[model samples]
Target: MSLEVKNLVKKYGDKTVVNDLSFTMDKPGVYALLGTNGAGKTTSIRSILGMLAFESGEILWNGGKLDTSKINVGYLAEERGLYPKYTLMDQLLYFAKLKGVSKEEAKKRIKDWAEKLQVTEYIYPPAVKGKKAKVKKAEELSKGNQQKIQLMAALISDPELLVLDEPLSGLDPVNADLFKNIIKEEVAKGKYIIMSSHQMATIEEFCEDLTIIDKGNVVLQGNLNEIKKSYGRVNLCVKVEGDIENLIKEADLTVVNKTPNEYQLKVNKEEDAKVLLEKILQTNLPLIKFELREPTLHEIFVEKVGNVHEE
Candidate 1:
């Protein structure tokens, strides 16, 4: 089933958080919503999930009105949604039951997810001979572990639509890799996923299409590759045995970044890069590396948003 959101709007009295937000996911792949804090990314997501009241919008699933209560949808919110004092297993079972999973089946799914998410030790302690294991409370787990439990609750029902907001946030490197692999596996299963994160590299890994919002407005949206192609290959990277700053200045190139032996130059056109390359080749310097490429997503995002401070 596909997910579509059109002309979504949310206002806080006089302040508009999301304005005319629109996007569609017609296939089973990851679509990323990217933005800085207070950029309407989360508000648009909550509206699409029916978790927030919107002034105007159409959220549709499979050509019909979307209803999370009746649809098989899983959401991992950026904000933690678990009860602090409740036992981890109890809360997970409750969440699963709320989603219409049978009690026995919920237990089975929880057991499986515990192993897959590497949180089994926290959910179920090792049994002492002739004694029962103690169940851990949510407050007892570390922040990273708590996040994993929340993820387990979201996936216990194996939903068709999954929305993850900052899924890898606050996770250690090992746990981050674990989450990434799990997301990859879910995509392989042909699930429609809507992800929002600040990690540009992670978004680049999973999303082919993306929308970047700034201050309640969409600033950029499209297939990532096509968008990059439109910009053309304007980035140049080079390294040589000796200093080439004088040559770069002579060629009239803008240095985006520079190190002792490496330089990241910004060019207006591919021809500009070619001119720089010709200048460098004419010299007797040893060329260690020279490459021209398109701007990165992070660079595009910054260019679109201007100098606004991102939270």
Candidate 2:
């Protein structure tokens, strides 16, 4: 099945928060939506999930209109949505029921997920030999563990379309790896996923296609590989023992970053970097390392959406 979002528009007051944003996923894979604060990334996602209204757009699932109420959809919102006082099992079952999962199936799914997410202790307390075991409340778990429970809720129904908004935001390194593995597993299961995260490295790890918005306009959208290829190998990194300031000045390269032993330069073309390499070789500057590569996702994002608010 395919998912399509065409000419989506969302406005508030006089400003358009999301202007004619569009993309499609014809198969199961990760699609990334990236932007700075208030750049309309969240707004656009809410519109796609039917959590918010839009002025104009066509969101199609398969060959018909897309409706979350009728479709099996899983969502992990940026903001945590569990009731602080409710028991973990209670919330997961409730969420699963809302998604039309049978009670028996929901219980099985919850048990499986708690073990997979390493939260079995919180969800299923072991029976004490002579004492009673109490159920765990949402407030009882740490932020990271609570995030895991919410993820369990999202996958309880085994949704065909999964939307994750900043799924790894507050996770530590270990939990982040755990979440990444789970995402990979979901992809292996052939699930369509839309991920939004400020972590450019994480986006690069999963998303094949992406849309980057800045001030409600799409600054970049395409296959990640193709986008990086288009920028060419303009980013150059050079490390030398002695001072090479004069060489850099003579070569007319823009120093993006620099340290005592290393310099990151932005060249206009491969020829410019080649010229700098020639200069370094001629001067015998004790070169330690030289790298010419395409711009990183982080670099590309900064270049396209400079000082813009992230949403």
TM-score for each prediction?
0.96, 0.96
Top-lDDT candidate index: 2
Per-residue C-alpha lDDT of model 2 across residues 1-311, encoded as one tens digit per residue: 99999999999988999999999999999999999887898899899999899999899999788999999999999998789999998888899989999999999989899889999999989878967888999999999999999999999999999999999999999999999999999999999999999999999999999999988899999999999999999999999999999999999999999988899999998999989999999997799999999999999999888744443
Give the per-residue lDDT of model 1 (tens digit) for 184-297. 999999999999999988999999999999999888999999999999999999999988889889888999999999999998888888887788788878999989998899
Q: Which residue pairs in model 1 clash with each other?
A: none
Model 2 pairs in collision = 36-309, 36-310, 36-311, 37-309, 37-310, 37-311, 38-310, 38-311
**Cα lDDT for residue 37, candidate 2:** 81
Model 2 whole-model lDDT (C-alpha atoms): 0.94
Best by TM-score: 2
Write down the lDDT of every candidate, Cα atoms only.
0.91, 0.94
